[model samples]
Target: MSDTAAERAYRNCVRNLLAQFIHAVQQQPPFILDECDEESLHYLEQLESLPGTTGNEYAELGQAVVCRTIAAFPHLVPLLPRDLLWHFGGDCLHYMPDDEIDKFQQLDERLHQAIGEARPFDYERERAAIFGLH
Candidate 1:
Protein backbone atom coordinates (compact mmCIF):
# COMPACT_ATOMS: atom_id res chain seq x y z
CA MET A 1 0.00 0.00 0.00
CA SER A 2 0.95 3.63 -0.49
CA ASP A 3 2.24 5.54 2.52
CA THR A 4 -1.09 7.29 3.17
CA ALA A 5 -3.03 4.08 2.79
CA ALA A 6 -0.64 2.30 5.09
CA GLU A 7 -0.91 5.00 7.74
CA ARG A 8 -4.69 5.02 7.50
CA ALA A 9 -4.82 1.28 7.86
CA TYR A 10 -2.50 1.40 10.82
CA ARG A 11 -4.50 4.12 12.46
CA ASN A 12 -7.73 2.24 11.93
CA CYS A 13 -6.33 -0.95 13.36
CA VAL A 14 -4.91 0.82 16.41
CA ARG A 15 -8.16 2.63 17.00
CA ASN A 16 -10.10 -0.62 17.09
CA LEU A 17 -7.59 -2.38 19.30
CA LEU A 18 -7.37 0.43 21.84
CA ALA A 19 -11.14 0.75 21.87
CA GLN A 20 -11.38 -2.89 22.81
CA PHE A 21 -8.69 -2.51 25.43
CA ILE A 22 -10.34 0.59 26.86
CA HIS A 23 -13.64 -1.21 27.16
CA ALA A 24 -11.95 -4.13 28.84
CA VAL A 25 -10.13 -1.82 31.20
CA GLN A 26 -13.38 -0.17 32.19
CA GLN A 27 -15.41 -3.33 32.61
CA GLN A 28 -12.70 -5.46 34.17
CA PRO A 29 -10.60 -2.75 35.77
CA PRO A 30 -6.79 -2.91 35.64
CA PHE A 31 -6.63 -4.78 32.36
CA ILE A 32 -3.15 -5.52 31.18
CA LEU A 33 -1.39 -4.86 27.90
CA ASP A 34 0.74 -7.93 27.52
CA GLU A 35 1.86 -6.75 24.14
CA CYS A 36 0.96 -4.47 21.28
CA ASP A 37 2.04 -4.03 17.70
CA GLU A 38 4.55 -1.31 17.04
CA GLU A 39 1.94 0.53 15.02
CA SER A 40 -0.51 0.27 17.87
CA LEU A 41 1.99 1.74 20.27
CA HIS A 42 2.69 4.61 17.92
CA TYR A 43 -1.00 5.37 17.60
CA LEU A 44 -1.40 5.24 21.35
CA GLU A 45 1.32 7.81 21.73
CA GLN A 46 -0.65 10.10 19.47
CA LEU A 47 -3.97 9.30 21.10
CA GLU A 48 -2.60 9.97 24.56
CA SER A 49 -0.98 13.17 23.40
CA LEU A 50 -4.40 14.80 23.35
CA PRO A 51 -4.45 15.24 27.13
CA GLY A 52 -1.25 17.20 27.00
CA THR A 53 -2.12 19.60 24.25
CA THR A 54 -3.40 23.08 25.13
CA GLY A 55 -6.84 24.70 24.99
CA ASN A 56 -9.80 23.45 22.93
CA GLU A 57 -7.29 21.71 20.74
CA TYR A 58 -7.18 19.08 23.43
CA ALA A 59 -10.88 18.43 23.03
CA GLU A 60 -10.53 18.28 19.26
CA LEU A 61 -7.64 15.90 19.58
CA GLY A 62 -9.55 13.86 22.12
CA GLN A 63 -12.47 13.49 19.74
CA ALA A 64 -10.20 12.49 16.90
CA VAL A 65 -8.44 9.98 19.08
CA VAL A 66 -11.75 8.48 20.19
CA CYS A 67 -13.05 8.33 16.64
CA ARG A 68 -9.92 6.65 15.45
CA THR A 69 -10.00 4.23 18.36
CA ILE A 70 -13.61 3.33 17.62
CA ALA A 71 -13.00 3.00 13.90
CA ALA A 72 -10.03 0.75 14.46
CA PHE A 73 -11.57 -1.29 17.26
CA PRO A 74 -15.14 -2.23 16.44
CA HIS A 75 -15.06 -4.90 19.13
CA LEU A 76 -15.49 -2.17 21.74
CA VAL A 77 -18.90 -1.44 20.30
CA PRO A 78 -20.26 -4.64 21.71
CA LEU A 79 -18.41 -4.31 25.01
CA LEU A 80 -20.24 -1.09 25.75
CA PRO A 81 -23.34 -3.08 26.68
CA ARG A 82 -24.78 0.06 28.20
CA ASP A 83 -23.71 3.58 29.14
CA LEU A 84 -21.82 2.14 32.11
CA LEU A 85 -18.52 3.00 30.49
CA TRP A 86 -18.93 6.55 31.75
CA HIS A 87 -19.17 5.47 35.34
CA PHE A 88 -16.27 3.11 34.90
CA GLY A 89 -14.12 5.70 33.24
CA GLY A 90 -14.95 8.13 36.02
CA ASP A 91 -14.01 5.61 38.60
CA CYS A 92 -10.76 5.02 36.82
CA LEU A 93 -10.13 8.74 37.11
CA HIS A 94 -10.93 8.71 40.86
CA TYR A 95 -14.15 10.70 40.83
CA MET A 96 -15.31 9.47 44.18
CA PRO A 97 -17.97 11.20 46.19
CA ASP A 98 -16.88 14.52 47.64
CA ASP A 99 -19.18 15.70 50.46
CA GLU A 100 -22.34 13.63 50.13
CA ILE A 101 -25.06 12.37 47.81
CA ASP A 102 -26.76 15.73 48.08
CA LYS A 103 -23.80 17.36 46.37
CA PHE A 104 -24.16 14.96 43.49
CA GLN A 105 -27.88 15.59 43.33
CA GLN A 106 -27.29 19.31 42.98
CA LEU A 107 -24.67 18.71 40.36
CA ASP A 108 -27.00 16.40 38.51
CA GLU A 109 -29.69 19.04 38.40
CA ARG A 110 -27.26 21.57 37.09
CA LEU A 111 -26.02 19.07 34.59
CA HIS A 112 -29.53 18.39 33.34
CA GLN A 113 -30.16 22.08 32.89
CA ALA A 114 -26.90 22.56 31.04
CA ILE A 115 -27.51 19.48 28.96
CA GLY A 116 -30.97 20.71 28.13
CA GLU A 117 -29.37 23.90 26.85
CA ALA A 118 -27.28 21.78 24.48
CA ARG A 119 -23.96 22.55 26.15
CA PRO A 120 -21.63 19.66 25.77
CA PHE A 121 -20.57 17.94 28.96
CA ASP A 122 -17.13 18.53 30.31
CA TYR A 123 -14.95 15.49 30.87
CA GLU A 124 -16.16 15.10 34.46
CA ARG A 125 -19.82 15.26 33.52
CA GLU A 126 -19.27 12.96 30.58
CA ARG A 127 -17.45 10.50 32.77
CA ALA A 128 -20.04 10.64 35.54
CA ALA A 129 -23.08 10.15 33.33
CA ILE A 130 -21.87 7.66 30.80
CA PHE A 131 -24.68 5.19 31.46
CA GLY A 132 -26.99 7.71 33.07
CA LEU A 133 -26.92 10.35 30.34
CA HIS A 134 -27.61 8.37 27.21
Candidate 2:
Protein backbone atom coordinates (compact mmCIF):
# COMPACT_ATOMS: atom_id res chain seq x y z
CA MET A 1 0.00 0.00 0.00
CA SER A 2 1.07 3.54 -0.72
CA ASP A 3 1.92 5.50 2.38
CA THR A 4 0.73 9.03 3.01
CA ALA A 5 3.29 11.83 2.83
CA ALA A 6 3.39 12.09 6.59
CA GLU A 7 3.94 8.36 6.90
CA ARG A 8 6.71 8.53 4.33
CA ALA A 9 8.38 11.31 6.24
CA TYR A 10 8.15 9.35 9.45
CA ARG A 11 9.53 6.22 7.81
CA ASN A 12 12.41 8.13 6.24
CA CYS A 13 13.32 9.75 9.51
CA VAL A 14 13.36 6.35 11.22
CA ARG A 15 15.44 4.86 8.43
CA ASN A 16 17.93 7.68 8.85
CA LEU A 17 18.12 7.02 12.54
CA LEU A 18 18.65 3.31 11.93
CA ALA A 19 21.32 4.02 9.34
CA GLN A 20 23.23 6.32 11.67
CA PHE A 21 22.96 3.77 14.45
CA ILE A 22 24.26 0.97 12.25
CA HIS A 23 27.19 3.11 11.18
CA ALA A 24 28.05 3.87 14.75
CA VAL A 25 27.87 0.20 15.74
CA GLN A 26 30.14 -0.73 12.86
CA GLN A 27 32.70 1.84 13.99
CA GLN A 28 32.68 0.78 17.65
CA PRO A 29 32.56 -2.49 19.48
CA PRO A 30 29.18 -3.00 21.15
CA PHE A 31 30.57 -3.02 24.69
CA ILE A 32 33.61 -2.22 26.77
CA LEU A 33 35.19 -5.63 26.76
CA ASP A 34 38.29 -3.97 28.17
CA GLU A 35 36.24 -2.56 31.05
CA CYS A 36 34.87 -5.85 32.25
CA ASP A 37 35.20 -6.48 36.01
CA GLU A 38 34.28 -9.19 38.49
CA GLU A 39 30.57 -8.31 38.44
CA SER A 40 30.45 -7.98 34.68
CA LEU A 41 32.54 -11.10 34.34
CA HIS A 42 30.00 -12.99 36.40
CA TYR A 43 27.25 -11.57 34.22
CA LEU A 44 29.04 -12.82 31.16
CA GLU A 45 29.61 -16.18 32.76
CA GLN A 46 25.93 -16.42 33.60
CA LEU A 47 25.05 -15.47 30.06
CA GLU A 48 27.38 -18.10 28.68
CA SER A 49 26.00 -20.60 31.15
CA LEU A 50 22.65 -20.47 29.39
CA PRO A 51 21.68 -23.14 26.83
CA GLY A 52 23.40 -21.54 23.84
CA THR A 53 27.02 -20.89 24.79
CA THR A 54 28.65 -19.73 21.59
CA GLY A 55 30.78 -17.64 24.03
CA ASN A 56 30.60 -14.58 21.83
CA GLU A 57 29.50 -11.25 23.35
CA TYR A 58 28.50 -9.83 20.01
CA ALA A 59 24.75 -10.22 20.44
CA GLU A 60 24.65 -8.54 23.82
CA LEU A 61 26.98 -5.81 22.65
CA GLY A 62 24.94 -5.29 19.52
CA GLN A 63 21.75 -4.80 21.53
CA ALA A 64 23.37 -2.36 23.95
CA VAL A 65 24.89 -0.45 21.05
CA VAL A 66 21.62 -0.30 19.15
CA CYS A 67 19.72 0.90 22.22
CA ARG A 68 22.30 3.51 23.06
CA THR A 69 22.42 4.64 19.45
CA ILE A 70 18.65 4.91 19.19
CA ALA A 71 18.56 6.84 22.45
CA ALA A 72 20.92 9.33 20.86
CA PHE A 73 18.36 10.31 18.19
CA PRO A 74 15.93 12.19 20.41
CA HIS A 75 14.81 14.56 17.68
CA LEU A 76 13.46 11.60 15.81
CA VAL A 77 11.27 10.66 18.77
CA PRO A 78 8.16 12.39 17.53
CA LEU A 79 8.56 10.85 14.09
CA LEU A 80 9.21 7.28 15.21
CA PRO A 81 6.82 4.53 14.25
CA ARG A 82 3.95 4.19 16.72
CA ASP A 83 5.20 0.87 18.03
CA LEU A 84 8.74 2.15 18.52
CA LEU A 85 7.54 5.45 19.92
CA TRP A 86 5.47 3.58 22.47
CA HIS A 87 8.53 1.56 23.42
CA PHE A 88 10.74 4.64 23.80
CA GLY A 89 8.11 6.66 25.64
CA GLY A 90 8.83 9.44 23.15
CA ASP A 91 12.49 9.67 24.05
CA CYS A 92 15.12 9.58 21.31
CA LEU A 93 18.60 9.06 22.74
CA HIS A 94 20.99 11.05 20.52
CA TYR A 95 19.25 13.93 18.76
CA MET A 96 20.62 16.35 21.35
CA PRO A 97 19.56 19.64 19.83
CA ASP A 98 15.88 18.75 20.17
CA ASP A 99 15.17 16.76 23.32
CA GLU A 100 11.78 18.12 24.29
CA ILE A 101 10.64 15.01 26.12
CA ASP A 102 7.30 16.41 27.21
CA LYS A 103 6.35 17.47 23.70
CA PHE A 104 7.22 14.06 22.30
CA GLN A 105 5.26 12.35 25.03
CA GLN A 106 2.17 14.39 24.14
CA LEU A 107 2.58 13.57 20.46
CA ASP A 108 2.98 9.88 21.29
CA GLU A 109 -0.21 9.89 23.31
CA ARG A 110 -2.19 11.48 20.49
CA LEU A 111 -0.75 9.21 17.82
CA HIS A 112 -1.47 6.05 19.83
CA GLN A 113 -5.02 7.19 20.46
CA ALA A 114 -5.51 7.68 16.74
CA ILE A 115 -4.05 4.25 16.07
CA GLY A 116 -6.51 2.77 18.53
CA GLU A 117 -9.37 4.14 16.43
CA ALA A 118 -8.67 1.76 13.60
CA ARG A 119 -10.80 -1.35 13.98
CA PRO A 120 -9.63 -4.76 12.84
CA PHE A 121 -10.34 -5.24 9.13
CA ASP A 122 -13.25 -7.38 7.97
CA TYR A 123 -13.52 -7.14 4.20
CA GLU A 124 -17.15 -8.06 3.65
CA ARG A 125 -18.44 -6.40 6.80
CA GLU A 126 -16.45 -3.23 6.20
CA ARG A 127 -17.66 -3.03 2.62
CA ALA A 128 -21.26 -3.28 3.82
CA ALA A 129 -20.63 -0.72 6.52
CA ILE A 130 -19.20 1.74 4.01
CA PHE A 131 -22.18 1.25 1.71
CA GLY A 132 -24.72 1.52 4.60
CA LEU A 133 -26.02 -1.94 3.84
CA HIS A 134 -24.47 -4.08 6.54
Q: Number of the top candidate by lDDT?
A: 1
TM-score of each prediction:
0.36, 0.32
Tens-digit lDDT string for candidate 2 (9-118): 44455445445533333234322456645654543344233323222454344334334435553443343333233223323333323434444554444434434554
For model 2 the local lDDT of residue 67 reads 46
Clashes of 2: 9
Q: State the lDDT at 26 in candidate 2.
A: 29
Q: Relative to the true structure, how large is the alpha-carbon lDDT of every model?
A: 0.45, 0.39
- Model 2 CA deviation exceeding 4 Å by range: 30-100, 106-134
Which regions of candidate 1 fall more than 4 Å away from where they truly are?
Answer: 1-35, 77-109, 112-134
Q: Across residues 57-131, which tens digit of lDDT does each residue of candidate 1 receive?
A: 754555555555456655544553222222223332222344433445454565565555655444344435543
